[model samples]
Target: MNQLKKPVIVAFTIITCLFSFSSCKKDSNNNSVDTDDPASADPTLTLVWSDEFNGSTIDTTKWNFEVNGDGGGNGEAQYYTARSTNAAIKDGKLVITARKENYSGKSYTSARLTTQNKAAYTYGRVEARIQLPTGRGMWPAFWMLSAKTPLEWPHDGEIDIMEAVGYRPDTTFSNIHCTAVGYGDLLPVPDYGRTYHVYATDWTADSLKFYVDDRLIVSYANAHLADATAAYNQWPFNHNFFMILNVAVGGAWGGINGIDDTIFPQAMSVDWVRVYQRK
Candidate 1:
């Protein structure tokens, strides 16, 4: 998710480049990198953190529920709440539900969970298994944002590992936002609303790779890393970033076709979240 606004709908174009294996380089590298290659499982990576969602309740020690009705800066219709009815652990999965209700001056209610102050990472492999919600109004996402206080969006950077709007049930989007530029791509993902699939991102100082069911879909290499005139706005992903999971309703992108009020009580079920770092 882009912080200030939803991503611009444009032709899907993957910004790709090559970098040295020894250091982060710019697009000038001579080696031709294939962005479509499946990122191989690294044996050196060890699972350093994980949430199996096996508990009876949301683990407050690792997550914080954001309560607000600020429209998520996207003209969203749902009011985020911290109630168990909005988010709960059931059947070994963290279920985030969006329901039709008049609450806090909003016509819909939902949940937004974050690992803001609880857990953050600089660079690693983060992944989650989730079964999404269907219908015309649902907007479910697994994303990350800078952990810096007094957040400054776009400049601080955002990584949208997975985003699926209810109307586009067979397509999922992956994007990265920065002050320099924002790039996104769409991929075909069948039965995403009814079946579980793994959404993952491998992040490093040099690049970001997005995967669905272990198949690489989008790969972005840092374009300003080796440039002498580059500024922080070109790449602000070096610092710590925390995770966010939410189900938004009638947002800028999700509400483009208007919402289907009949599909209330939609839920996004997250089976597990795991983070890995090189050991």
Candidate 2:
């Protein structure tokens, strides 16, 4: 367990004078305030979850690269590749890219990475700092799924912590989905695309809170969702879950604007992902 703190947006997003990142600097939101860079940032909370990717290659001990399109929810269009275009680790960041080039019988390519077995958590605050891939027809997500499915999908439960489709530049979606038995909710955050932003989800025994910076966008009260048996009958966010990071192209949710050939090999760089729990 980690220390607990109040959920404040500015404090959670970027504490001034500590290591605040302005998207204009790197032209990509993938970099956080460099620890040794000396740029001052003032944040009250200490580091809990982070991937300062300081190595020459992916950290096999902390993450696993998902290398197949077959597991992409049945409608994902891109074949996952291990190449730099699809995914690569460089300059201390994990970059996930979506491409339109043909490869191995698929017209598009992308990367999906996860911390399925390395780490799993039941609650607290989970955050991922990210800069999105540009152009139309792209879908990127920072999400989680129950590692131990009390029942299969629609039953096991899913937490779409942060998800955005390129066509809607200003609309961000923070949602949850369950079996057809329930009409899950898709909470909206309208400013997710205009710039780099941190998407967060806070969970406790009775509810889940969606946030964009300091704003509490939506709250899912436990009494409103799923049943006790873990069926799609309710919101099932009570179990341990693993994380997933991916940029998908031309899939059912992504292909809306049509693929932009000129933006081939666009990337969604992640600054880091950190989790918290009640101490």
Candidate 3:
């Protein structure tokens, strides 16, 4: 009787151990987020500047819209509009929407907002919490261009903090463009449309660090920033740059998707945009 009782006790103990191990394994996949409200998120960054977009309308005082005629960007077929139809503030967020409607000869419509005359920064961490738009022919971006460019693009340079095309919803890219290097795009992830992620850049005298959701992706050092090599033209980023936000439809880069009229008024929603200077 004693031996039989001992075997039963061992069997029970083994079963309990297996159950606990299974529970731990299940918890590893439950990537739970905090229960805190977005508005209540702690400010861990130094607020050097921002466009909260809190007003009833786009605070034109801090931003201006670009209205590109039908042949925008040199024959690109997008009639960029500044109207509220293209961009608006609703429920405490900035929405840049694009549609496949004909206002005139142009077949597609969208918005492009800029801070060229409003804000300029030489070195700082620029961040935006954004979610991408879905469907082909949709192109959304957060970027910067030379604030004081007398000539044209490529000469002044371009910095793409984040750019995504609906056709390639799986990937978002960050790239630097100059006359010498031409242009380069990289794959940061496979699927960006599934969730809201933080797209950010920390630019300093030393280098620029690219991050997504506090996770570091790549760091370009000052040497690379100042590199005079023909492949990496340094003139573009050495000067000040202003910010731009937009959602383009059926353009050179976006038009590759043909057109999806069914997904009219697709929005690139931005939760927040913040800039921080070093302490």
Candidate 4:
């Protein structure tokens, strides 16, 4: 979540609040019921935007290729490139390949794609079906960051819908990073590298829920808002955020356990990415 270093500590403080009887509406039986409860009336979801990767080439209008060799502030070994070899659409899937080679003074080459200025959303349900690559040093992630100008890391906020380090091929992580706190949750997907899974997050003003294959794994609420000391740093999800998909090579968490050079060519194949909003 730190972007520079994955936090080693997993500390989460969950605060629960009781529903106020005064806010409840009376039912036919004179029973108090919260009509505004999300469970009582779930909104219908409408597909607002999506990319099935059915085209022959990457859709430049929707995605931007980020080319950099800055290590992503985490000592990553790969240089992100815009070349087709690093990122391309094939067989109805978006393939992001990481290759071990001598390129631009780096030992690895990978791709990073984002929907920054081209598209951004405030709150909704975002999901992606992806098949990950395995072997140590590989780090694949589908995440989001604030789209606000003059980007601020950890301050503007970050949401990691799915992150898998090759060392732990069976486990995937979801996390939220803000100035107030950074917490993460993990889910085990057997044979993750060989299978495809839907990683998603339902974000609203009240909470953020993460899921794998539609199974809920993590639920983070805006509990800090009730505290008098809380500020924008505690909850910065009110603004627009852009999505990012990438496979980072050996940096921080992914590189903690040394990389296995034998696995030279690894790739993350994305089947589709869809965004839905309550209609």
Candidate 5:
């Protein structure tokens, strides 16, 4: 009887061990995120700056309003307003709304928020989690500009982390704009207006890698910008750059087809903006 009982207990122990091992394997697999970038999972990346938009109001210390309606040289229709109706913080997110209403002689009103003089960084991983607004002429962008004074645009280099046109709901863009390399690639992704997606750029002295949700989409190298004759023309990114977030209506890109007045009061919702640097 004692021998029979010992066999039964050993058999039960073996089954229990196998069950625990299988459960552990399943949990490990489930915890993994679909990503190719090593830094996406690396624990060493330090959060240098971030805005979660937790309060009832936007933190003025971090962002300033680019209040104007001059079309930004793009023939945009929206008059960018500095009022809370156009830009506000609610439900733990920064909401930039574009409305089809007359304001200051413009047919539409929107908001452009910037971190120009308030915050700037030279190189790091800059990203934002955003859900785009939808409409015929809606154009939303999360981009960067040189922090230098006198505001040289393309000469200073522009880094468009994310740009989406409402006419093309299935595509977005990421590009490095300079005199030498001034082109962008259209990336087709799942409908960005339907859900929040992360748009990010990993920038270093030698390269700029664009990513969507940790998946690398395109990479632009600094080899062309390294030429001494074209350094100023191409590599103005050596200095710090500040970020801008805005939604424009009926601009050059968004107005390609024309504005659909029915989609009034469209909004681009930003969950958060984060900047991480190597530790």
Candidate 6:
């Protein structure tokens, strides 16, 4: 009887020690959740495409320069050029500079880069980390347009993930343009123009959600635009769309106040552009 009792006691002690160790490890792991990285927190997102701008030169295969001084139909002051002076890559960043100079019948020069026919996506998450420029006339935008061959402005649809007028340094705009403009709430962040921020849009069949640093700032649901016919004019986002990045000087909205010559040579730098989809 004594031998049996000793063996039983030893087994019970070993089991207790194992349980305590496992519980402590579990508690420690639970308390150490990382919150700084958005990807780690979001388990469903899978990276589909990305341009880190890691090289010293822009990848021609991914982006094409829209070489024109058409003012982008906004009566903008800058002449969009394909020169490296207006757009260049350095230190893993794509810089779009708006310079004050006489060029091609325009008073200023800038660059407009697009992934129009080169690349397009139906729906997913698209985002960019950008540092904006400042001045009275500076207009920087990160947006998307429909890939329709015969594109009609404000009719095919436009998704503005981010837009900022130089005069308003602390405000950011996100909007959708179709038959009518559907604007999002103005986001006021501290030192917005001077600091880098992540602007993103999660697009799906039913809704489009805009985010800043993974925080949802605005959302537009198809239900709001739903009508009897469900025409393409109202819900044109169902088709594939491409991305565009540009810095316009003194446009219809950006130049509402006026152009500031002192802010010439202003630049908007993009750290990276990423696309993702649900796993």
188-274: candidate 3 lDDT, tens digit per residue: 565466556778887886666666676665555544543465424554566688888987666556666576778877888876677
Pick the lDDT winner: 1
How well is each residue in 187-266 modelled by candidate 2, as lDDT tens digits?
44454544456677778878888776535766766774445554435766767888888887765666655777787778
Mind sharing the TM-score for model 2?
0.77
What local lDDT score does residue 5 receive in model 4, on the 0 to 100 scale?
Answer: 57
Which stretch of 10 consecutive residues in model 5 shows the poorest summed lDDT? 1-10
State which candidate, 1 or 5, has the greater TM-score: 1
Residue 36, candidate 4: Cα error in Å is 30
Candidate 1 local distance difference test against the native = 0.82
Q: In what order do the candidates fall by lDDT, top score first?
A: 1, 4, 5, 6, 3, 2
| Candidate number that wins on lDDT, 1 or 2 | 1
Top candidate, metric TM-score: 1
Q: Name model 3 segments beyond 4 Å from true.
A: 1-45, 70-75, 182-191, 224-232
- Lowest summed-lDDT stretch of 10 residues in model 2? 1-10
Global lDDT of each model?
Answer: 0.82, 0.64, 0.65, 0.81, 0.77, 0.76
Off by over 4 Å in 1: 8-42, 224-231
153-186: candidate 6 lDDT, tens digit per residue: 6677888888888777777777777764445655
Cα-based lDDT at residue 167, candidate 3: 72
Every model's Cα RMSD, please? 9.9, 8.1, 17.1, 11.1, 16.9, 18.6
- Candidate 5 TM-score versus the reference: 0.84
Over all chains combined, what TM-score does candidate 1 have? 0.87
Sorted on TM-score, best first, the list reads 1, 4, 5, 6, 2, 3
Poorest 10 consecutive residues by lDDT, candidate 3:
1-10
